[model samples]
Target chain A: MALLIAVAADDSLREQNVGQSLQERVPGAATVDIHGLYRAHWRYLVRLAVLLVDDTPSAEDVVQDAFIALHRRSGSLRDPDAALAYLRASVVNLSRSVLRRRQVARKHLKVAEPQTVAPADDSVLVRDEHRATLVAVRALPRHQREVLVLRYWSGLSEREIAQTLGISNGAVKSAASRGIATLHRVLGGAPDA
Target chain B: MRDGMGPDDIERQLRDSFDARARAGVPDGAMPPPPRFATAGAAPRRHGRWLAPLAAAAVVLAVVGTVLGLQSGSGHHGQQPVAGPSGRQTSPPVLQTSATAAPVDIRMVPVDGATYGVGMPVVAYFSQRFSSAKPLVAATSVTVSGKPVHAAWYFEKSAKPGYPVEGHLRMRDYWPAHVDVHVTVAANAITPATTVNFHTGARTIAVVEDAKHQMVVTSDDKSLGVFPVSLGTDSTPTGRGTKVIMAKQPSICLSGPGFHGCGIKYAQQLTFSGEYLIAAPWNAALGLRDTSNGCTNLTSADAEYLYRHLRVGDVVKYPDTTGPMMQVAGGLGDWNVPWAVWLKGGLIPTG
Candidate 1:
C-alpha cells in the first residue's frame, strides 16, 4: 500500500508539471501531451508529409494527426525513444492509406474531371534542363522519393530514414539505390564514378 | 567565361531554372518540420538492452497461436510460427510455416526483366484450386540454392492482416549464381507441389512462370528496358522531383545503408543522381503510374527489349508524370552536366 501510494503521488506530480510547463508555452497545449514532441519534430514531419502529399495544408494535417495518435499512445510507449519512430511510422502508414484510397476515388472522378496533366506554373519559365532534372526526381518510386527527400532535402542520416519509415535500413538502401538509378535513366546521365 | 560557361554550363542554367521551379511550386502556409526528433539520440541506449527479450517474447507468442489454429483445422499438419514473448495473445507474429498432410501446391518466381534492380521485389503466387473454396498454396521450404528464404505469402493481392505468412522478404543475399534457384513446397500429396527456377545472366534475366500464370522478373545484367514507375509510400513519390539516370549495369548488386534491423544486401540497381534506388520487389502495381521516387518502371518484357537496344548515353524524360520519361535522343540533352558539384550546390531542397 505504501509503495502503491508513493507511485501514485509520483505519477500525479510528473503529469502535472509536464502539463503545466507545456500549457505555459502554448495556449491550449494542455489538450495535447505531445506538444513537446510536436515542437521537436513538427517541421521535419511536415517536410516529409509534404514530400508525399504535395499540398502544405494536407501535410500539416498529417503531422497533427500523428501527434494526436502519439498522445493517445503515450502510455503504451514505456520508453520515450520509441515515440519518434512510432510517430513517423504512423504518419507514413496514414499517408499511404490516404493515397491508396485516393487512387480508388480517382477512378470515380476520372470521367467527370478532365485529367489536366500540366507541369506546375513555375516549371514553365525554368530552363528546359532544370525542368528535366526536377521532373526526373519526381519520377522515382514513392519510397525512393521519400528517401531522397529525407536524405537530401532534410539531410537526415540513413538511420533516420529507416526509423521514420518503419523499414529496415536495407530496405532504405535498396529504395535509394533504385530511385537514383531510375533518375539517372530518366535524366540520361551517369553516376559519378 | 565571365558567366562560367563550360561543359556543365547548361547544367548551371538548369540548376538555377530548377531552383526557381522549386520556389514557384512552394505552396502557401506549408511549414517544414524540424530536421529530426529529440528522442532519437537516446533511443538506442534505452532499447538496446530490451531488444533480445522483446524478440523472444514475440516468437513464442507467434508459434503458440499459429500451432493451435492449425491443430483445430487439420489433424495432420506441421506448423511453425515466429513467436515472441506475449504468451498467446500479443501483436502479430512475423514469420509462420506449416506442412500439410495432403500435397500443398507451391509456385516459384524469378526476379528478372528490363527494370530489374538489386532490391526489386519478386513475388511467387501458388495455388491449388479446389471445388469447395478459394485455392490454397502449401510452400514448405523456399530457398535460393538450399539457403532458406523468408517470403510474405498471401491468397490475395493486398498483404492483409492474417494469412500465416505474408509480408516483405529480405533476400538481398542467398541468391543463386547464374543458375536455376529451385523452390519446393510439400502438399498433402493431392496436387503436385510446384517448383520455381530462376536464372539471372549478365545481359538479361529470365522469369519462369509456374503451371499457373504468374510473372516474376529478375536480372543481374543492367540490360533491361525502361518501365513507367511511381514513388512508393514516402512523402515525395520517386518521380516528383528533379532526377536523371546516372548509371547502367548488366547485373544485380546490393549495398548496406548502415541502419538497425537491416543487414541484408540490395538487388539489381539503377542509381538516380542524388536520389534513391528502385528495388525490384516494389517494381509493379503499387499505386504508381509512370511516377516513382526517382526511378522508372518497365514491364519485364519491355525492359528486356530495351536492355538489348538502349545504350548508356540514351536519355529519359518525365513530361507530366512523377519521374521522367525516356527521351533517348534529345529532350534532356540540354541539361546533362558531368563536371558540377550539384549535390553540394545547396540548390537541392533540404527535406
Candidate 2:
C-alpha cells in the first residue's frame, strides 16, 4: 500500500521543513519563513493551538514542539506536504496532553485557577460581546472543544480528525455533533450554568 | 442540514471567530521569536509547568486514544451526544403554533427621523421575545439611499425593561456618508409592518492610538486632522473598540473618585460606563501624556470643533489600548462586534 497520509495536505501542512531549521530554538528559521508561510501556516498553527491550549505562550510552545518533531522526522518522510500534517497532528496531541494534565491536576489539587477571565490584552482581539461565545467554547468538555475547533476552525474531515486525534471516525463525528449541540445549548439563551 | 441552521451557522461562527483570533494573534511584525530546536538538540528549556503537565499528558495520550472507551459515558447523559452535521440529529425547526398569542411588535429606534453619524446602527426594539427570529429577520428590511447594500437583521435578547429582544440592522461595514436610511418592517403574524427613515450626515471616525496619545480624525475616510489628547489614567483605562459617540454635550460637570469640576465642555459619551471624550483645560499639559479618569481630553477648541462636526453615532475607535472591550448592548458598539459573531446574534440569543 502507498504511504497512507491520514490527513490531507494543506499548503501550510505541506510547507516543507522551512530552511535549515523549523525548531523553536532556530532564530534563522524566522527570517526564512517570515514572508508568506510564516504568516499563513505558522501563525495559523499557533492560533489553532491557542484555541486548544487557551493561551498564546502555551500555543507557541505547542507549535514549537510540533515543528521540532517534524524537523527531526523529515529525513525519513518522503513527502514534504505530510510535514505540515505531521506538525498539525503533533500540535493537537500536545495540546490535548497539556489540557488533560491541567484538568487532572486541577481536579486533584483543587486549584481554583482564574480559568476564563480573559486578560485585558486577550480582549484586544475578541470584543466584549463575542468574548462570551469564546468563553462558552472554552467551557466545553475538553474533547468536545477539540473536535469542534478542528472540524470548524481547521475545516478538517472526519477521517482527518480521527487520524489526528487518534480516534475512530465515528468518535470524531459524535464529538463534532455533540460539540455543536453543546454550543447551541450554551449560546442559545440558557442564562445559567 | 435542518434548513442550514443545524450546525452551519454555529460552524460558520466558529470558523470566523477562529480566523479573527488567528489574525489578531500577535501584533503585526511581532512574530514569535524563532524556535531554538535545531541547535538546542535537547528539548527546549522545559518550564516546570509544561514538563510536569507533559508527563501525565504523555501517559494518557499513549493509550492509542481508544476514544474514551475506558470511562463510563453516563456523566454527560442528559446531553446525549448530539449528532452534528456528521451524524443523525437534525435540528428540528422551532415550530411556533400558538394562534392566540399576541403578534410580536417592533419599533424603530431614533423614531424622530433625525440625521445620525455613519456609525449609527438601525435598531428595531421588539415588545417581547419570540421562539423563532425567522419572522423578525424576514420582515425587517433596510434600503440605503445611495449605494446598494445588503444589510441583515442580527437578533439578540435585549436587556431593557420593556423590550425583551431587538434586531439590529447594519451592513457588514459602515453606511456611506450623507445617505438616507429607510427601514421598513412588514407587518406579519409576528410584527406590525412600519417604516422609519433617518439620514447619515458624515463619515467621521476618530482613532485613538494610546501609544501616540493623539487622535487622528477622519471625515468621509479622509484624514481631517490630528489632535493631541490625554486619555484614561492607569486606574481608569478607556474602552478599546470602534465605539460610536452615543451622545454629546456642549458642557458638563466632570466628577470621579477624587476629582469634581462642573462645566467641563465638549463631552461625548463613549461607553455606558461613563467614559467620555471631553475638553479639559484643567490638564495643563494635555496630549503630552495619559492622565484623564478615562475620558479622552482634548483642548477646548479641538473639542468644540469635534462637537460641531461629530454628531451622535459618529465613531471614536481606540485601535490600541489595554482597556475593556465595549458591548453593543451597553452602548452604540454594534460596529465593534465582528459581523460574523454579530450574525450569531448576541451572547444571549432571542428566546
Candidate 1 residue-wise lDDT, B5-100, digit = tens: 332433333234333343333311112221112222222122111111101000000101223333344353333222211111112322222334
**How does chain B score by TM in each prediction?**
0.26, 0.68
Candidate 1 on A46-119: residue-level lDDT in tens? 55665565433344556666765676567676544477677777777766665565566577777743332232
> Per-candidate DockQ versus the true complex?
0.05, 0.05
lDDT of 2 by residue, B125-240 (tens): 44334566655556667788844467766666443212334556788998888988777767654655677677787788889979998999999878878999888877677878
> iRMS of every model, one decimal?
23.7, 22.6
Report the number of the highest-DockQ candidate.
2
TM-score of every candidate's chain A = 0.65, 0.69
Per-residue accuracy of model 2 over A87-144 as CA lDDT, tens digit each: 7888888888767766776777655555433234443545333466677888888778
User: Chain B alone, model 2: TM-score?
Assistant: 0.68
Which consecutive 10 residues in model 2 chain A have the weakest lDDT in total?
A1-10
